[model samples]
Target: MASQNRPLSPHLQVYKPQLTSVMSIMHRATGIALAVGTLLLVFWLIAAATGERTFGDIQAFNASLIGKLLLFGWSFALFYHLCNGIRHLFWDAGKGFGLEAAYRNGRLVVVASIALTVLSWVWGYASMGAL
Candidate 1:
């Protein structure tokens, strides 16, 4: 009876985030973000195909503060997915399997994702002259 309801095993108090754990959770998170972000892409594409009126509506919405915030998140998610995907490619090649290497590469993915997102936004705004 005493052992019937014993607390299973290690608890949350013992859980420290490791690189693999972080990556695992982030991979799922980015997957969800990517899926949600696709709606924006689809909207843009449909607007483009349907002509200016529809596109203008989309543009108006996109220009709104909330829309801009969503777009920023979408952009970041895109870059994050891309960076992590590259990390996965390296893993497929049997590299960066060690804990320290995984942590290093995980950080690299985060830094690269942010950098690429900012750089992309800057260049895009510059090219379009519409910021």
Candidate 2:
């Protein structure tokens, strides 16, 4: 029989949030966001094939404030996912195992993802003559 006074395992409340833990959680969240974003992409493609009215409606929505916000968020998620996936690849190859190295890489992932997203959006707008 187990002791009633003692818990079987440490609960989440007992632990402080660390960079690795936060990054891991974000990695999973971005993955889910990417799936949802992919659905949006599919919807756009379907609208394109459906008719001009349908496609125009989709385009109009994409040009709206809320839609742009969602698209920006999705782009961030995409870049974040890509950066973190690369970090995982490095880990799988037995690199960045130290605590300091892990933290450094985690910070790099965040910075790189943000930079890439912003650069892509800027380039996109400039190409579209919207800049």
Candidate 3:
């Protein structure tokens, strides 16, 4: 066959990122993060059931700086996934279909997720007398 130069198909570099698209990608990522976070929860639970020594070790690690950072990330992921899930429900209900509405809802999901995560951490710390 004779070589004929044809235009390449559009790829990631060809498209500009939009708010809705970014949020959609984040939704999947946060979902994965939540799954991993659940594993941590199960580990903690098993440790608690096993004995004091195992539980104490888990607690100690959980109280460490790195652990706290991971917990913070996991909490944020949880809230983000939750808010995005609700947004998805709205889409399922045939709402937020317009571009403007999609952008608006995307912004709302981002703001609500951050607010909820912060509030939850604050409440948790206060309840623990660590605030």
Per-candidate local distance difference test: 0.88, 0.94, 0.90
The digit string of per-residue lDDT tens for model 3 on 23-76 reads 888999999988989988999999999999999999998899999999999999
Instruction: Give Cα distance to truth, residue 26, candidate 1, Å.
Output: 1.5
Better of 1 and 3 by TM-score: 3
Per-residue lDDT of candidate 1, residues 1-131 (tens digit): 89998887757468997767777778789889889888888999999999999999999999899998998888888888888988899999999978889989998898999999999889988989887
Count the clashes in each prediction. Answer: 0, 0, 0
Flag regions of model 1 displaced more than 4 Å: 1-14
User: Candidate 2 — which residues are off by over 4 angstroms?
Assistant: 1-10
Model 2 lDDT, residue 53, Cα: 99
Comparing 1 and 3 by lDDT, which wins? 3
Give candidates' CA RMSD values in order: 3.7, 2.9, 3.5
Q: Per-residue error at 84 for model 1, in Å?
A: 0.8
Tell me the TM-score of each prediction against the true structure. Answer: 0.82, 0.89, 0.89
lDDT of 3 at 27: 92
